[model samples]
Target: MIEFWLCAGLLLLTALAFVLIPVLRGRKLQAEEDRTALNVTLYQERLQDLQAQNAAGALNAEQLAAGRDEAARELLADTEGAQALPPQRTLGIKVPLVFALLMPLLGYGLYQHWGAIDDVERARTFADQPKTIEEMTARLEAAVKSDPKSAESWYFLGRTYMAQERAADAAQAFERAIEVAGRAPELLGQWAQALYFAGGKQWTPQLQALTDEALKADPAEVTSLGLLGIAAYESGQFKQAIGHWQQLVAVLPAEDPSRQAIQGGIDRAREQLGEPVEEAAVSAGPGLTVQVALADDLQAKVQPGDAVFIFARAVSGPPMPLAVKRLTVADLPAEVRLSDSDAMMPQLKISGFEQVQLVARISRSGNATAGEWVGSSLPLASKTTEPQQLLIDSADSKAP
Candidate 1:
C-alpha cells in the first residue's frame, strides 16, 4: 500500500510540474505585439517623410524611387518577422487547472486498469503459493486470458488441468495450443500426459499414439517415458515398461523424488511379472481411507469429465497443506470411498494425519461449482469409519 501511494504521489507531482513548467515560461504576447506595431508605424512614418520631400520637389525621381523601395523592404521584413513568432493563446485558469488535475488521474487510471505491472505482481504471488490442481487450473485460465499468445502458459494450463483430472478441458486446451505451436516436443509431452491420464481403465492404442509422438520428438523426456512405462506396466507389458523405466532412470537424477517414485512403480511391475523386487529403503506408511462426500447431489449440474480437487490438511499444523488429490468427474464416485489400498493413494499420505481437514471440490469451466469440506476428528490409527461420505444434494432453505 505504501508503494502504491508513493508511485501515485510521484505521478501526480510529475503532472503538476508539467503544468507549472509551461505556465512559468509562458511568452509575453502583449509586449511582442506592441513591439511589432511600433516597428510598422516607424517604417510608415519614414516613408511619409520621403513622400513629403518628393512632393516638395526637394528630391529627384531616382532618389524618391530608392527611398520608397527602401521603406517597402523595411515594412516587408517587419511583417515576416512578426509572422515568424508563434501566436499566444489566452487560456482561462480552468484550462491549466483541469489539465493539472486530469493528467495524473488519467495516467493512474490507465495503469491500474490495463497495465501489466499488477498482473505480473499477481502472477508472481500465485506462483509463490502452493497451488492446488484446481487453483492452478484457474490461474492458467487467467494467465491465458492475460496473455493469449504465451505458449508456456497454454502448455502449463493443459498440463495443470490434466493433473486436476479434467481431461476434456485439457484436450481442448492442448488442441488450441497445438494449432498455434505445431509439433513442439514439450507441447506433445503435455498433450500425451493428458491423454495418458484420461484414458484410465481403458487406455489403449490411442494412448500409445500420443506417447509415441511425444517420445519421437524428445526421447529423453522423463514424463513421457514415465507415462509410457506406466501404460506398459498396466497392460502387463513388463518388458516394455522396464525398458521405458530404465531409460527414465538413466536420464533422471538418482536422488530425484520422481526417480524414487518411478522405481517403486517399476518394482511393482516387475513383481507382477514374476520378476525379482528391488529392495529400496522406501518409507512406506500405513494405509488409510479418504472419503469424498457432497452435502447435496451435484451430478445434474456437474459432468463426469469436469475437474475435481481433493485436499487434506492436518488439524494441528501450519496450513502447510498435507496432501492434495485431483481427479476427473469420471474418477469420482457418486460418493467415492478411497482406501489406502489404492495405488494412486501413495502420492497422498492419508496415514500421516490422525485428525485432518478434507475438502472436495469440482470446478465447472474455471469456477467452483460443487464443494464439501469436513473437519474430521478421526485419527489415522483408528479404524476408518463409514468412510466420510459427502452427499451431493443441497439442504438449503431457498432454491439455488
Candidate 2:
C-alpha cells in the first residue's frame, strides 16, 4: 500500500507539471512584456528631451537627430526578443493557473469515488502464502471488509472460519456470500453445514430448508448430501444416513480421496443398523454380465450421445444401486459386468444382496434416476455368471 501511494504521488506530480509548466512560462512572458513597455517609455522620454534641446537652441538639428537615433538604438536593443515572443494571452493564463491548483484535488476526489485502491491493497496482502490459519483468516477478514461485494472473498473467509472452528462466524460469512452471489447451490450447502455445526449438531427446520433448497437445485451437491448424512447419523436415523451417504458416494469420482472417508461413514451407519459386516476381505466376487441394447422403436427418440446407465439394485433392500456402469447410446449392445469392484459404496456390494434386479436406462439429460427409456430384468441371483440380455424397450415411467 505504501508503494502504491508512492507511485500515485509520482504520477500526480507528473500531471501537475504538465498543467503548471505552461502557467510558469506565461508568467515569464508577461514579465518580459512589462520590461519591453518600460524600455519604450524610457526611449520616448529620451527622444522628447533631445527634441526640446534642439528647439531651445542647446544643440543643432544634426546633433538632435543623432541623440534620437541613439535612443532608438537603445530601445531596439532592449526590446529585441519582444516581437518574437508569441503574443501573451492573459485570457488563458488565469484559467490554467486555477486549473493547475485544482487538478490534484479533483483527481484525488475522482479516485476516491471510482478507484480500485482497496483491491490493489488486498492483492498485495494475498501475494504471499499465509503461514498460519490465523494469518489467513485475518487476511480474508480484511479482504471482505474492503470488498463486501466480492463473493469469492466471502467464500474463502467462510471456509477459513470453518477451519478455525468458528462455525457461527462461518455461517455468517457463507450467508453473506449467498447474498452477494445469489443463492448458489454450493453456497447454500456450505451455509447449511456451517449452521448445523454451529448449533451443536442439532438439526433445525431452517437447516432442513436450506439443504432441501440446495439439493433441489443440485441433487448431487456433495456438501449438502454429506451434511445430511452426518445429521442423520447423529440423530439415530441410520437408514437415512446410509441413503444420503450412498448418494454422495455415487456422485463422487472413483479416484476421489474423500470417497474413502465417506465410505467409512456409510459403514459406521450400517453398523448402527446391526447389519452383518463381512469379515472376509472382499475381492472381485462373481459378477453378473449383461448386454444392453436400445429398442428398435426408440432408436429415433434418443441421440447416440445420450448416456446409458446400467446397474444392479437389491430386489427388496435400499433403492441405491450396488454396482453401476455408464455408457453412451452408441455403445448399445455393449457387454458390461457389475461386480464388487464397481460398488458405489464399499459396504454395499452386489454380493451382499441375495437377489438383485438389473436395470438399463437411457437418459438424454445424463441423470441416472430419470431417463427417457428404461429396461429391467426380473429378480435374479446376484451370483449369476451367465450373460443376460436387456432391452430399453419401455418408457421410463419412474422418471420424474
Candidate 3:
C-alpha cells in the first residue's frame, strides 16, 4: 500500500511540474515584452525626424521613402527579436499529452512484463493449500528416484516434511540437500525454517546461522522475512518485527498475498505489544478434504503417499457427473470413505452415488498420478454404504 501511494504521488508531482513550467515561461515573456517597449519608441522617433527632414527640404522624396523603409525594418526587428531566441515548451499541452498517451501505455507494458500479480497469487494458492504427509513423502521418493542429484527436490522434500510436522525428518532432508546443493539461498531459507520448527520455538545457534546465511544471500527473501519476523516477535522485539514486515510490504506488490499475510502477522505482533493494528481479520474461505485408495488387489505395489485423482459419476438416468477429488498418496487409506463428515468434502445430497470408481497411478513425479479402477461401472443402489475399497497388485503397479 505504501509503495503504491508513493509511486502515485511521484507521478502526480511529475505531471504538475511539467504543467507549470510552460505557464511561468509564457508569463515571463509577456512581462519582458511590456517592460521594454523599445519598438514603439524607436519607430516614433525615426518617423518624426524623417518628417522634419522632409519638411525642411533637407531630404528628397526618394530619401524620405528610404528613411521610412529603414525605420520600419528596425521596428520589426525590435518587436520580433525575442521570438527568435528560443521556442518555449508548453507544459499545459505537453504534460497532458504525455500523461494521456504514455502513462497508460507504459503502465500496461510494465504490468505485462514484471508485475507478477496473478502468477504470485497462483503460487501462493498452491503454497497455502494443504497436503497430507503421505502425498508429500511419495513425491519426494519419486523425485529422488528419478533424479538423485537434484538438490531442489531434496530441499522441497525437507520443506514438505516440515509441513507435516515431522521436523526431524525435515532437518535430515535439508541437511542432505545442503551437502549436495551447497549454500543456495532458497535452500538455506527452507533449511532455517525447518531448523526453527524442530528447535522447540527457541532460536538455536545453528538455526541463527542458517538465517544469517539466507539473509546475506537475499535480503528480500520472503521466507526469511517471515521467519525473522516471527523470531523477533517471539523474543519480545515487536519493533524489530514491524521493521522487517514493513520492509517486506515495501518490496511486495500492492496485491501480493505475502504482503497481506505478513502485514497481518505484523499487526498481530504490534497489538500484542500494545500498538494499534491497522487491519481486520482476513477471511481464507471454506476448505475440503478428500481421500483415495487403490483396490486390495493392488495394495502391495501401491504406496500410501502416491498422488491420485478420484472421479464419481452418477450411474442412473442421464449419467451425470457426481464428484471429483484430487489427492496424494499420504491421504490414502485401506478403506476409503466419501461423505459429508470430512471437513474438505463438498456438499452433495449424499444420496446420488450409484457407482464409484477408484484408480491408482504413479505420476511422473514419483507420486501416484492415477488410480486403478475397481468394480464395474454398473449402477449402485445407494450412496451411503460401507466405504469402497479398490485393490491393485504390486506387479501390476510396475506394469506399463
| Model 3, TM vs. native | 0.38
Better of 1 and 3 by lDDT: 1
Off by over 4 Å in 2: 52-59, 80-83, 88-92, 276-400
- Give the deviation of candidate 3 from the true structure as CA RMSD: 18.3
Worst 10 residues of 1 by lDDT: 337-346
Indicate whether candidate 1 or candidate 2 has the larger lDDT: 2
Residues 152-271 of candidate 2 have per-residue lDDT tens digits of 999988876774458999999999999999999999999999999999999999999999999999999999999999999999999999899989989987745456557767778878
**Residue pairs in clash, model 2:** none
- Alpha-carbon lDDT, every model: 0.63, 0.84, 0.59
Question: How many backbone clashes does every candidate have?
Answer: 9, 0, 33
- Residue-level lDDT of model 1, residues 309-330, one tens digit each, is 5555556543433455566667
lDDT score of model 3? 0.59
Clashing residue pairs for model 1: 293-390, 294-390, 294-391, 296-391, 296-392, 296-393, 296-394, 297-392, 297-393
TM-score of each: 0.51, 0.65, 0.38
Question: Best TM-score goes to which candidate?
Answer: 2
Reference-based lDDT, residue 110, model 3: 84
Residue 172, candidate 3: how far off, in angstroms? Answer: 1.9
